[model samples]
Each structure stands twice: as C-alpha cells, then as structure tokens.
Target: MRLVPTPEQRELRDAVRSFLAAASPMPAVRRAMESEPGHDPEVYRRLTGELGLTGLTVPEERGGTGAGHAELAVVLEETGAALLPGPFLATTLAAILLTETGEKEILAGVAAGTTTATVVLDGNRALNGAEADVVLTIDGDRVLARTDGERRPLRTLDPTRRQALVEPGGEVAAVSAAGIARARDLFAVAVAAEQLGVLRASLEAIVAYSRIRVAFNRVIGSYQAVKHRLADMHCTLEQAESIVRYAAWAADEAPAELPGAAALAQAYLGRACFEVASGSLLLHGGIGFTWEHDAHLYYKRAKADEVLLGPPRVHRARLADLLEL
Candidate 1:
C-alpha cells in the first residue's frame, strides 16, 4: 500500500467523507445511536452494497475487492470522524480474524456484508456485541465460532458504537491460531486509524469554531492562548496520523515491522486522541459542554477507544517487549 494516498485512495476518502457528511450528520448519528442495531440499515447497505468497503481487505476469492489495509484505513477514518453509528469496525474485525485464520466460509459472508459478527473479548464484554449474526473468540489456543446467543446490550460512552454482553452459544467450527496474534496487532493499528480521524475531527471543530465564535469583541482565535492550544493539537494530530499510516503500510508492505508499528500507533494515538478532543471541547466553551453538543460525542469516543483495542499502557508495554527493551 502507498504511504501517501494515491489518487484513488484520496478519491475514496473524499467520497466516504462526503457520503457520511450527507447521510449521517450529527443529528443522524444521534438518531441512529438511539435506534435498534444502533445504526441505519439503509446507510449500512449503501456503504457495503454500493461502496464495497466491508470487503476492502478480504481476498477476491472470498468475495472481496482484494484491497489492502490502506483502503480500510481510509474508510474507517471517515466513519470515525463522522461518528457514524454502525457495526462496520466490529464486522471488519471479524473479517480480519477469519481471513487471518483461513476461515473462508465465514469470511465470505462477512466480505459480502450478508453476515454480522462480533468478537467477545473475554467472557464478560463483546465488541459490537449487539445485533450480530455470529460471535467469535479466541478460546484457549483455538479460534472459536458460533451463532450468536442472547445478547444483552450495554450502555457505553460512545453511543455511535454499541457494546454488549454476548452470551455463550453452541459451537460452529474451530480454526487454527496461525495468524491470530498478528491479526490482533493489525486490529490495534486499525483502531488507531479511527482514533486518528477522531483527533483530526476535534482539531477541525475547534479551529472552525475559533474563527467565528466571538469573545470579548474578537474571534476566539485572536487570543494567543487559543492559538497555542490549537497549534499543539495540530502537531499531535499530525503525529497520530503519521504513526497510523505507517502502521497500516507496515501491515501490508512490510510485515516484519507490523507488531512494533501497531503497538507504537496504539500507544501514541490513543492518548493523543483524548487530549485533542478534550482540548477541542474546552476551546468551544459552554456550548461545547452541553449535552446536545457534538464535542462530547467525540470526547466520549476518544475515552472509550483509548481502551477499545487495548489501553495505551498495554500497547506501550507491548511496544517495549516487541523492541526487546
């Protein structure tokens, strides 16, 4: 995959950004978050049926486009920035794990967006647990798969993405753990890419507000304090984006570097995303702090995502171990 966005990747990014801008604005996000399945099925259909993004990474033999991580990264960033309430990321995770473990049957349904799958992290919590057609987990040394059992949805800070308690079900099939660990590292990279979008959205929100929101007879951006904070946020956003891009590139073009790159991405981007979002909220003042404000949505998502793939500390530790420190 290219490090800099090729013309096609940029086009895809713009298209996704534009589509989400129209189809799932903050109001739509709020509405979708409150609805069952936590997203609009029609919107999801367009994303998969029209755009063919759900299978961006699955092989062509498995009904996918045979695209790479860069494509997935592009789509996810746009979705994350827009706070689209969908099971996209979770479904992608399931696709990735199945692809990694060579489970072609399950991968085909996932790639076609005909099946929804969720990952049970422990016995306790599930990532995108609600409204899934299948549930998968790493049971001891084997990868376990089963039709979803009764789902108990949990209220999470990020309403745009739901979590739940996925109860145990009868067995479906088992697969080898050939690339499961690598798949997880790649998943961290994927999560960090979304966080990159969240941080970028935060900075853009504050900057746009600062230019117009008047305070003391001048735009807030005129204040040196606000300028400095925005500058810091921009710098941090750049770093997060850089690491995430490298992580994605490594997963595709440089397999040997993926573990360290993925760990580094999660370690840095996770915390930076939270800081940028919280800073954006502060810059927006009273309006941003309100319940109806969109700033809180990004802020809450940043907090949740910091630990969604794995916490910053855990990734940092993994980075250290990978580097043999």
Candidate 2:
C-alpha cells in the first residue's frame, strides 16, 4: 500500500491551494516579485491572520495552534505550487529551530503574525534575508542574530522568491551543534516539500495543456511520445512526493529517519522538479518560453529551488555519507 496524506491534511492542502489561486495568481506573483520586500503584505497578513497559518506549527503557549511539522509541510507544498513569495519558509524554519533554543518570546511573536524572521544557517546569505525583522546566522560554532546589518539582493533564477547576502552581527542566541543540524534538517524538508509542489503542478499544467493544445488536427497529448514523457514525469513526482512525506513525518515522529529522509528527498526532488518544469515548458511549445507565460516562472523556480537546500549532487553526497557509503 502507498503512503498517503490523511483526510485532514488533504483539507488543509486544498484550502491553501484555493486561497493562493485567488490571492496570488500569476499577475499577483509577478507584481510581488517586482515590488520591494518581494511579497504582498496583504496576502501575507491574510495567510497568518485569517488562516491562522503562522501559528500552525507553533505551540499554543506561543500563541500558535500547536500543530506539527506535517501541517506546515502541507502549507509549504501549496505555497510551492502557487509560487507564493516572501519569508514563509524562513519564518517557519526560525520558529522550529528557535523553539528548540528556548526562544519563547520570539516564537510567540512569530505565531502572532507580528514578527517575521529568517536564519542564515549556511553560507554567507539567507533565504528571505532582505525582508526579515530578525536574521539568525551561524558564527564560529554559535548561532547569532543581527543587531545591525544590510541585505544585498542577488539576481537569482527565480524572481518570485528573493535571495540576499546578509552580514553577521551581534550574537543573539547560542545553539549547539545538534541544534544547528536539527534546524538544517527541518529546513531541507521544507524546501523538499516546496519542490514537490512544483513537480506536481508542472505535471498537472502540462497534462491539462496537452489535452487542449491541437497540432495538425490532433491533440498534442494524443501523441505517444508526449504521453510517455508525461508518464515519466508523473512517476518522478509521485516517488519524490512519497519521500517528502516521509521526511516531514520523520521530523515529527521519527528523529532517526530525518537526516536520511531529508537528504533523499532533496537529492531526488531537486533534479526531478527541474526536469518536470523544463519538460512542461518544452511540451507546451513556443508559448511556454514567453515571459508573459507562467511556464518560465515555474522553470525558474524549479532551477532555483533545486539548489536552495544544497544542489542535487550535494545532497546526493550527503545521502551517501549518511548511509556510510
């Protein structure tokens, strides 16, 4: 039997999907990408306020609904499919890791939708670095928060999501090696979930388009080659999705499996999602390459997200090492 999401998880996924379809359609995503802070404040507020999503994973004491990482994974998947911008992933990671550090005040603010934060767990930059109220980073075996710094935006492949270089500042929190590893694992799972959404969305878009796109008086989807490629993409998406679910579940119920599951998902889903996005564009013919089309956006996001949690090879190597290869 295949592992599947529970009925409640399905409901949450559908709600987020419906909300994004209306609030962050292609035009809205394009506008948000061009605007400063790279997200719609109104939509972000609605996500946290009306949906109470900001508090989805945070405990009740911290003003959150006290849900688990699985619920957050559902939201992340929808955001990925919608290409919802801003610091959603960053803020979620911060809440999870900071909670482990006993940062209750900050977690409370996060769940309340009043404060947004991000962590530069690796490298010199942070995802969603430019628009966070608080930025956490690693400095010489310690986790520090910036008292003062500036974000230098980078022109990445995906405009829907923003990336920036952040300089470190005063030490705000001290986290152990274990905490750092834990945070990184959780972050990887979130990234994997988003990529999973992209994969699924790409297949759906291509499938729908193929059915209606006529070529030489024949629907493009009726062609055998097109059918085979789409079939392969569907297989990849389904397998990668299973891995992503396992990773999310591991984060909540089985800590021993988290590292392996996260790495496997990251390694496999990165390239798989990229292929699906690229394939969707190719299968759509010339129209897919145009800027006015959303295919390019998905392609760009696929490439960017592929490298976000470390590239495919990076995770592949990690997986091997984790397996004692």
Root-mean-square deviation of every model: 1.5, 1.6
lDDT, candidate 2, 1-325, per-residue tens: 2257889999999999999999999799999989977999999999988898877878788788988778888999999999898888888877877776767877788888888888875586777888888887767557677735788877777888787888877765777877778778888898888998988888899999999999999999999999999999988987988898889899889998888988898899899999999999999999999988899999999998888877899999999999999
Quality of model 2 by C-alpha lDDT: 0.86
Which pairs in model 1 have colliding backbones? none
The 10-residue segment with the lowest total lDDT in model 2: 139-148
TM-score of 1: 0.96
Worst 10-residue lDDT window for candidate 1 reads 169-178
lDDT of 1 by residue, 185-246 (tens): 87887888899889999899999999999988999999999999999999998888888889
Residue 171, model 1: lDDT of: 46
